[model samples]
Target: MSQLQAEYIKRILSARVYDVSIESRLHAAPLLSRRLSNTVLLKREDEQQVFSFKCRGAFNRIYKLLQENPVSGVVAASAGNHAQGVALAARELGIQAVIVMPQTTPGIKVEAVRAFGAEAILHGDDFDTALAHALALGEERGFPFIHPFDDPDTIAGQGTVGVELCRQHPEPMDVVFVPVGGGGLAAGISVYLKYLRPEVRIVGVEPIDAASMHDSLKADQRVVLPQVGLFADGVAVKQVGAHCFEVCRQYLDEVILVSVDEMSAAIKDIFNETRTLTEPAGALAVAGMKRYVKERKVSGQTLIAVTSGANINFDRLRHVAERVEVGESREALLAVTIPERPGSFLAFCQALGKRAITEFNYRYADSGTAHVFAGVELPGGSDERDALVQGLTDKGYPVLDMSHNDTAKLHLRHMIGGPARVPSERLYRFAFPERPGALLRFLSAMGQSWNITLFHYRNHGAAYGRVLVGMSVPEGDEAKLDEFIAKLGFTGHEETDNEAYSLFLR
Candidate 1:
């Protein structure tokens, strides 16, 4: 082992964590075991003080620093968990601490630091901005800056998680999954594990959209990301720390990137399995474990996934709940363009068969053309969904499948359908060929007598098409409408009173 690795292990073992910190429960997860075909153990570090394993490192690092310097206080910059860690630790140690945070940080987190008795200073808009301010404060006040992840002391302090993991499980763990942000957690745990138990493989998980560690390891050096996704706020670091990178390069067996969808799904899984609502970063280890088992084919081995923390924002849960179906492949969004004809709408509905309509939106203008947005619940298999799309395309409709469109899945569909004010209005849906002059034919048949009220549509990469049209008419014009729609011979539905339409597309 290198001298630094040896020293890290020594520091971890010699650290003075409270007796309560030494023993976290290691419980088997049957749900994960079934999915991965391996015995999966969860290290419940989310139950720790500050609801994160960060406290362990912060406590140890501050104690070690104070023991050495004695007189100087500590300062740190963080948006959430790290700030809580330093504040709680400093308060426990009777040391003055200042936590610099971004002005954009949520109110809950700002109050958390204050509750821990740390002087919380709101600085700039992001972590880097806060860090810059903290650095200036540290220099001006002659206080030691406590880096969240970079320093040797912090890395060694985090190694204590590995120590506890080893002590808690008697059976040999074939693999250990750790979340990577700035690579501190991965570096510390992997170094300690590789030294003490060389047989165990260490895998680091990162959010796909904010994968600084994965990119760094791929480039064979530390590289900074131009932008980071904030969904997993705790692990949305733009760059991996230099010291942490060195340790990670030597000890980490592999780095895996999980999509925001996967992390959200894992968050739901954690809640279901342990009744714990972990933040996206906290669920990363479990998500990585699932990916590792599939990619590495370690089906029979005992695996451990670190459940790092549970400080999730309550408002974010609604977003997670909305996308969980998409993440699990249970929902699909499709854009279809159909002939702006009467019978065309009915034909499309018949093609959809019995699938539940989660969303339906459409727009018609320029007299002839129309665009439609539709979402459907999928049956069991990818094959089934593909067949459904193929069937729709075969009927001369241009269809665009967005079952995996991240943007649409995250924001668009939920806001597409709602109430509108158009009395004597009848709503009809149709599928048409996305071609020049398709709408002209339908509008020519409907004529200028009927007043069109609402129209909305977009292309989603489909050959065939779908659209929704709202028409306002005189109360006694129902018979005239039936004759007008019958002349077009397009597949469609008079959805004016359809309960589904009223609820989601009124």
Candidate 2:
């Protein structure tokens, strides 16, 4: 081992974190293991007192600072998990703590800091701004600023995780995946693990949009990302820390990137296995492991993922759910062109055969051809989805695979309709079973009747699927439209005069 690795190992052994942090349990992810045909283990750092592994680093640094020189108080800047860790540490040591958090920080985290008996100050709009204010406060008030990452003591503190891993699972392991944010956690774990088990691969995982460590390693120097996506806010650092980058550059086997959808799917996988929800950043290692296994076609080996934190906003679960299917390759979004006629939808359904329809959207865009936005459930992932698309193409239907299209997934699905000049446009909402042939049944029932002008349906995994449809009805034939709907025998409500339709879709 090199001198730096030896030093980190020594520092990690003597780190003072047990007073404030627990030795989190290592869990075997049975569901993930079965699916991947490998033994998948999760380092359950999310079970810490502050619901993150950060408590270990935060406490270690604070303990060392107090040992060297007694301080009355300390300050820290963090938007989420780190602040809670710092606050919990200070409370345990009976010292005053002030945590400066971004204005956009979730209320749960801010309140969590305060609950830990630390004074939480909301300042600035982002982490950088809050960090600057924290530094200024530290200088003016004669308080030491506890860094979220980038400090030697902090890195050593995080390294305790590696120590526990070695003791808990001494069996052979093919790879250990660590999440990389500012790089402190990765650096700590990599140095210790690599020094002890040179044969074990230590891979760091990062968000593709916020891959500071990956970019820095490629450039052979720390490089700041111009901007970062906040979806995985915990690991969205612009630049890796100096100490962290140096250690990681030397010890880490490699770094890999995962997309937001992949992270979301990993979160779902964790929930399925452990019945626990993790933040996007917390699930990074799992996402990376999945990608690595698939890309390398490696199986029947031991793999570990560090589940870092669970400090997620409850509201964000909705967005996570929406993307998880796509992330898991279990859903495909497509734009298909079918002739603008009464039986086009039924023909499209015939083309799809027994495959389930997750979503369908249409509007009266053109009289020549109608564009349909659809989400098809995929039981067999990418290969199956490709075959389905190819099958549609063979039948003379033009298909645009929008599964990887950002705009199509995020915006176009919801905004596919607007005002149309159809002479007698009327809107109605319908509810039916969210299963195969359900849409076909609806389309078949309304066959060739009064020109279906608009249609939208999305399956939310509930027993019933909801749909909004617009139809062209001659002025004197309003009763006939009602009769047509009554005969269809589906539950629905008329929205022809709905305020939203009047303003936009009408």
Candidate 3:
């Protein structure tokens, strides 16, 4: 073993998280195990006091700070779970703590941090912005700025989770799936497992839209994501931490990217197994594990997935329920254009034949053909969705697969209106990590300068969400659009030329 690996194991062994955090149980999911024909185990970190395993690292780092020397206080910025961890840890350690959060953070999270006795300061519109404010405040107040991840002490603390898993299971793991956001949890678990249980394969899971670690590994260096999806908000860091990235690059066997639909399905699976619902990020391990198992087609092995956190809003469950069917190859979305005449609808329905229709929306177009956005429950296996699309196309109908279209899912399905002759309308789609006031932040960015022509927003029960905003931009002010979007600190694109937008709302 490397000398650095030895030190990491030592730190994990000496981690004092028991003072504030509990040893989360390794729970067996019999249903899941049977379904997959493998021993599926869930590391129930969501059962922690803060409903997240972050408390372990937070307490460990603060406990070390206490041992090293005298400290004034601690400060951190988080939109969710980490803030609660730092707040409670600080209170337990008899030290003052300050937490900075984005202005758009949910009220529940803000209240949770305040309840733990931290001075919660709301700042900026996103995590990156809030972190900047926290660092500045820490420097000004002469307090130690506690990072949510990245610090050596914090990573060591997180490694204790791996230690507990090995102690609880007492068997060699075939593969372990860990969520990768800033990469702290995966790095910690990877290092510890590599040192003690080298037989165990450690794989990292990332949301496809917010895959900083996956991108970094592909690049052989850390790479910053231009934007992160909010569907799995718990692990939505735009850039993997420097230390966390280095450790993961060395220890992780591979990384898996999961889609929002897969995450929704995983949430349902976890709920079915344990009668407990996990947030999108919390269920990522299960989603990725299932995908990995399907691709590898290896059965009768031990697979472990960390159920990271469950700070999901109640309203988000509906969105999950909406997408779960499609995510598991149980459903698909398609835009089918048929002739605009009587009996044409009946002909389309007869062609689909017994395949369940989950959703269908159509509006009259003053043209020869009419477009219908349809969602249908599909049959089993991966190729079925493709075959269905192909079958529809072969039936003398022009079909556009809308299973992965942002415009189709978020707006076109609901707003299937006839085209309007707006002279200067421009459409843009923006994606941001979802919190309490995410829409408000977008509106703030919009300001009162432009006339709003049309708008659509939907929450897909993931850490990230998207908005389609239509504005009337004058010819002379077109140059300002790029600058405005760049300054928003989130990812967005112009969809004025999108066929759906042009056909329906433009």
Candidate 4:
């Protein structure tokens, strides 16, 4: 082994985390085990005092900093779990701490940091912006900056999780799946496991939208993601750390990318097993493990996944529940064109034949054909969806499968009740502050001139409420609509040109 690897092992072994950190439990996931046809274990770091494993690394780093010399205070920038980690660690160590979080961060996280006895400051729109502002403040205040996941001490501190894993699981582990964001936790655990149990494979899981580690590994170097999905906010890091990337490249067997739907289903799975709702990042390992098992067709092997944290807000459950069925292949969405004549709807219903229709929307497109959007629950999986599609095709009904259409899933599904009544329909998506009376603010601006033909907005527990608005604005009145939108001052753009709108609405 290289000298660097040896040093990491030493740091992990001698980590001074016992003062404030507990060895999180490794528990059986009976539901997941039965479903996957293998023994499944979950490292329950969500059971930590802060409901996250981040405290281990934060405390270890803080403890060492105190041992080295006297320090004024520590400052860190984070949108979620890490902020809580530093705050709790600083409180236990009797050191002052300042945590900077993004202005867009959910209210629960910011309040939790302050409750932990740290000074919480909300600034900027996202974590990167908050991080830059925090560094500047740290420099001006002469307080040391505690990086969320980039530093050596932080990575080594997190390595202790692997120590506990090795002690808990003496039996052969086929694979240990870990979630990767900025790569600190994955590096810390994988390197240690590679040293302690060379036979075990380490797989890193990341959301496809925020696959910084996966992209970096593919390029054989660190790469910054241009944009990341905010649904999985805990792992929405744009880039990986330098040292963390090096260690991961050396130790990680492979990195798997999962979708938002898969992560949602994993959240449901973990909830069913442990009665705990984990954040998207926390459930990533379970999601990845399932995908790996299915793709490789591997079975009868013991698999372990780290349930990293449960800092998710309660309101996000609706979104998770909505996507879980599709992610698990238990639901299929379809677009069908049938005759506009009477009794055609009845014929379609008879053809459906009691498959339990989850959702249905229909609107007259013309005198000849009517367009319908429908979702069906499939207990028998993708084969059922295929068979139904073939049956419909054989019956001379034109069908378009929409299960994989993101535009249809995220926005169009809610807007499915057909086209606008008036001529010249234009649709726009708007993002408004998610405060009480926010929708009222938009409506008050719209006035009574244009008829709202289509509107889809359901609260999804986000800082911004997404609204799909279809307005019947007559030609030559476009400038007025533009003027109104500009004066409204909300962030939005026209979705009229989107193909989904043309297919379903126009």
Candidate 5:
């Protein structure tokens, strides 16, 4: 073996982490295996004492530092898992630990560090500022700064995970997916796995919005990202560390980038399989592995994904739940246009026969045509979404699929409702089936002689779909409109004179 390989392998074999870190389980994912037709395994490092694999590297690095030379205390800067890891390790060793975290760091993480008996200092607003302050503090206090991922000892410590993987799985393996943030974990795992197995492919996974390692690998040099998405905050690093990049460049077979939705879907997948919710970063390897399996159509191969941490903030779950469907291609958002006439909305609903309508919103913006923002649950995934769009376009509806539009998903849907002025307009509130043909049948019975101005419908996971409709009647048609509405076979009432409508939608 080459000296570099020999050195890291020896270091990994001798690393001191068991004193503070456990050998996490290599769990079989039967459901995921059946879905992909592959033998999928998840390395559950999220089950660590700190609920993260970071303690392995942090403990090893600090333990080794003390062995070579006596140190009274240690200092480190991190806003997430690493801070907790370092503080825990220092406490175990009976040494003082100073952790500098960003002021914007969640209170949960700050309190977690303090719980580990470390001095938690809030400084700056972001990680970079906290890091600078930590470095300066270390110098001022004459204490060693425990680098999160760059140091040789740290990488060696993280490499222990690979040692356990080989010992535990032992069977033939096709690929191992490791999450890359600053590249430390990837570097450590990739080098050891490649050296020991040589043939097993080691793939590094990164969030597309924070893909410093992937970009660096492609460019054959380190490149800093201007900014990174914080959905997976644990791995939202702007640049890969120098030592980590060098090691990963040599050891990793390839790097995969995944989107925020993919990660969210992956978190859901992990939860479905293991009954455990992991932070977004913890699910990166699974997200990348799923993408790889889909892109390559590879089946029956043994694949492993390292679930790195579970330090998720509770509030992020709602956002994750909202985006998981789109991430998995199980929902499609659409913007459809129909004529601003009485039967047009009914015709639109008819075109969407038998498919569950998830959302619908409209307003009387123009007299000639109206735009509708809609969401449909896709039982058939992307293929169904494509067919639905094509069918709508073929049937003369101008459909713009916003399923993949992040901005539209995040903001445009909520911003779609507002006041509009329409002369002789009458509004009605109605409830119909949340299912396929209820709206179609109700609107069909209501007749198409008058001009339909504004409409809104939203499915709230209930049996009934609530709708608000506005119609233009030429004074004489009020009774005619009421007569048609009374026979529509659904519960509804006129809201034209309602004070709330006058205040908001008039």
Candidate 6:
């Protein structure tokens, strides 16, 4: 075995985490385990201090550093759990500590560092920027720099998780999924596990948009991403660490890239299984496990997925909740155009049986056409949705179903209405079947005569949904539009000039 791997195993065996700090409950999710036909165990590291396994490494590194140098103080840069870990470790060691964090970091994390008796310095916009500032300060102040990861000691410290995992489940595991940021957790656990149990596989999970480790492993060397998606902020690393990558290259079995949507869905699944909210990065292991089972077709093998952290921004939960169903393939979005006529909407609704409505948006101001945006629930699968869309098209309605398209979901759907026709003075809200061809029927019936001025629709994670629509019509066209709308059998309102709708559009 490599010296690094040997050292990591030795450190893991020797190190000791506070009894209260080590999480023991390995949750067995029957729903997920049954799907994969494997005994799936979750390592609930989110139960650790600072709500992350980072504390394990921080404490281990600090303890080792004190033995070597007996430092009076230490300095580090981090935006989240790392800062809290170092602060708590330094305070416990009776040593002064300084943490440099980005000014954009949440106030809660910043305050938590200070509450742990560490001096906190608000610096640049991100981890790298704060790290640069911290390094300069460390040089001038003569304080030891405590790296968040990358150091041998830190990697060894994190390997303790592997020791715990093995002790918790002595049975052989086919795979152990670990989330990778700078590759600290992955490298550490992989090194320890491979050395101790050569038969077990170690897989690293990273966000597809921030897959530094995946890129690095592919290149057979470290590589940096020009941009990283910050949705999974905790593991939004641009580059893998040199030390961690070296270990990963030697010990990790594979690296998997998971999408933000998959991670969001995994977070929702984790909440359902464990009733605990996890950050996007925290849920990555579970997402990876699902991807692995599907891709590799592995069955009857035990799997362990590490639940790494739970320090999620509460506001972002709204976005996750809205996209969860779609990610899970339970909802579909569609863009359809319908004839501007009466009774056509009702015919479209009848074609789509009991599916729920999640969102609806329509605009009727274009000189020759109107558009309707709709989101439908498919508690069933794609076949049912395709049937609904085809049924509407068979009835002579021109339907465009974009529910499965990502571009439409992110940009076009949110801004469906524009100044294609005369400006409208009024806005209206309406609801129709949240089915594939429902939008097309609604648009076709609105006809080429009326103009749409504004429209907005988003899936609100509900059964019956609502849509905000705006239209420009001639003074006497209200009766015609109402008459047309009433024939559709869907509830609609003439809020064309409503203050709230007008204000929101403006």
Q: Rank the candidates by TM-score, best first.
A: 2, 5, 6, 4, 1, 3
| TM-score of candidate 1 to 2 decimals | 0.81
Candidate closer to the true structure by lDDT (higher is better), 2 or 4: 2
Among the numbered candidates, top lDDT falls to: 2
Task: Estimate, for each residue in 181-202, the C-alpha lDDT of model 5 and write its tens digit.
Answer: 8888998998898888989999
Which of the two candidates, 2 or 6, achieves a greater TM-score against the reference?
Answer: 2
Q: Over the stretch 338-359, how does candidate 6's per-residue lDDT look in tens digits?
A: 6544333444455555566566
Candidate 4's C-alpha lDDT?
0.85
The parts of candidate 4 lying over 4 Å away from their true place are: 418-506
- Whole-model alpha-carbon lDDT for candidate 6: 0.78
Structural similarity to truth (TM-score) of each candidate: 0.81, 0.96, 0.79, 0.82, 0.90, 0.85
lDDT of 4 by residue, 1-506 (tens): 88878989998988887776788889999988998999999999999888888888888888888898768689999878899999999988888999999876767788899999999999987678889999999998988888889887889988988999999999899999999998899999998999999999999999999999999999999998888888878888888999999899999999999999999999989999999999999999999999999999988999999999899887888778889888988888899888865456656756776675555556555557777777777888889999999999999989999987889988888765755454787889988887655655565566666755555555555788777777768889999988888888899899999998898677
lDDT of each: 0.79, 0.91, 0.83, 0.85, 0.88, 0.78
Give the Cα error of residue 181 in candidate 3, in Å. 1.2
The sequence of per-residue lDDT tens digits that candidate 1 reaches over residues 249-364 is: 89998889987877887888888889999988899999888777767787888999998878887888877876666665666778887766545554555577766555566544
Point to the candidate with the largest TM-score: 2
Pairs that collide, model 5: none
Q: What is the C-alpha RMSD of each candidate to the true structure, in Å?
A: 8.1, 1.6, 13.4, 11.1, 3.0, 4.3
Where is model 3 more than 4 Å wrong at Cα?
A: 418-506
Weakest 10 consecutive residues of candidate 2 by summed lDDT: 443-452
